[model samples]
Target: MARPRKPLLSRERIVDTARALVDAEGLAAVSTRRLAAELGVSGPSLYNHFRTKDQILEAVADSVSAQVDLSMFDAADPRDWRTALHDWAVSYRAALTLHPNIVPVLARGPGRRPAGLRLADAVFGAMVAAGWPPAQATSIGALMRYFIMGSALGSFAGGFVDDETAYDPADYPHLGQAHLLAERQDLIDARAFETGLHALLDGLAAQYEHMAGGEGPGRPAGDASTPAEASPGHP
Candidate 1:
């Protein structure tokens, strides 16, 4: 039957299967032999799609980047770029968190990677359109990557020891109250992410206002986003 249609494997399938393998186990779990067995194809057949395991990993990382939501920043009005970028960053980090095994690999660089380049282009392009200097936009992109990768690699506040005896007041009084943090571990990390994100955005807004020479971060006369959403108290 036409040689079984070349065993029905594409680069997409290989990348997807490789990603699942990485997620289920670890990066080391992915191999041509293992992948071929999982895909029901011979080991040598995988070479037709990817030349090396590292190549498969690069493709998998790009696939993950491809899932980040960029719709918020793709709107006609660009004033919401700060908020839009914040939302996008949240989605990006969430996606990276899913595949923490690949986060370190992704940090290797975005050279020749379609999904990573697409993500970078979208963020950088939106910032430039929003009146940010090219240099500033580039710096913002780099900063975002740093923040996102760090978040993926580790927790902001580790769960505290709940046992009271673990803390000897004579040695450290503060340790006794540490148990409260265990209850709010997720809240603490989320708030810290938001706080840092907003601080960065606030600084960027100031720069944009100065560079635009306009009515600060608010809309001048008629604009979408900030103007429509700006309240008397906020303005």
Candidate 2:
């Protein structure tokens, strides 16, 4: 009999199954035995595709990296890096938001992951082309990753999910206002993300101008704009 057109088991198929498992039941559910069952293959069959669970998890994490848009760095104006970085951040956060289970692996620093390495190379090259020092460019990438992953992993508006009823108004009057935060939680979260994003970019913009001796992307040369006030906490 002729072999099937597509193999029954493949690395891509395994990663897809693992991604689904992670999305639905979290990373803990993606063990070889369980994933094998999901794939309708025996446990040993999985070994043909992946040596260890961590290897599978790494592929799964790269799958998330695949969702990011690196086009901003491709054959485009280098000066637009701030905007590019902003767009990249938006895409990165959106991707990870869907797969919060993969953030831990991703946070380990790209390592040998193909997609992750490509992403790092693009961002670093773009910033370096835009007149940023290698050290600063690396720092910027790390900072964005830290902020975006942290944001994606956390519930920014979780406090506003419901009224703050734990503390009585008598002694903890300040705590009682927590319920008010629940109103317009979406706007609260969006504004907060934008605020943080802008602040990070603004600081970089200032540094970029200082280093490049000219205008940074989307801003006048020597632009050192103040950070945005997204919430009551920021001054």
Candidate 3:
């Protein structure tokens, strides 16, 4: 009897391999021939799984989205919303940073992949559970995603020089002084990811509070008493 053959590789396997390759060597390193070689299969075999390189890239993007863990925010804990959002942003930025090759691909929508849609749905759901209206939740989630992705791209670009780049003091005195200060105390150690994430969350939280307050106890226009007027004192 002939030896049993190994099971045929699926598209998931192909995309997983592509993701690993991109994470290790970047987007340019992934191609039909290269991935086939790595998988011990012929280029034609890859065609059976993915029609083209773009298809493989889309799969890889979807795979990355599937990897996101949203279970941490499943509970209705409004108190922990900030921390949860921060953690989520950090995880997202780390994933993008690790696989900078997929950044561009993800910058485009990953189409109707279940994983991609679920990721968006999870974000919006979490925001809604955390006191945002449906419309505001969707908007905030989208805004946060855009901001985080942009920040990741900038971070991947290795933002802001320390003291190495040349600077002209006469023409740009403030910038030159700022650069000097940055180098003197190593202020360049400031993390773009953390700073951007917190700032975005803070702004979002403030907006949510404003919206919620607008809907509470002060229904009619101009009938809501100011804080000072509400107090038991002459105004």
lDDT of each: 0.77, 0.79, 0.68
Per-residue lDDT over 57-107 for candidate 3, one digit per residue giving the tens place of the 0 to 100 score: 988987777666666577754436677777777677667766767878787
TM-score of 3: 0.75
lDDT of 1: 0.77
* lDDT tens digits by residue: candidate 2, 1-235: 9876977899999999999999998878889999988999999998898999999999999988989988888875563989999988888887987898888888887888889988888888787777765556666777787888788776656665464666678987777666666676657776788899999999888777666665333333554433341111100
Q: How many clashes show up per model? A: 0, 0, 0
Q: Looking at model 2, which ten-residue stretch has the lowest summed lDDT? A: 226-235
- Runs off by more than 4 Å, candidate 2: 1-5, 77-79, 159-164, 180-186, 214-235
Which pairs clash inside model 1?
none
lDDT string for model 1 (4-121, tens) is: 5554799988998999999999899998899998998899999888899889999998898888887877756553878888898899988887888988788876777887877888
Q: Worst lDDT window (10 residues) for model 3? A: 226-235
| RMSD values, in order shown | 8.4, 7.7, 9.3
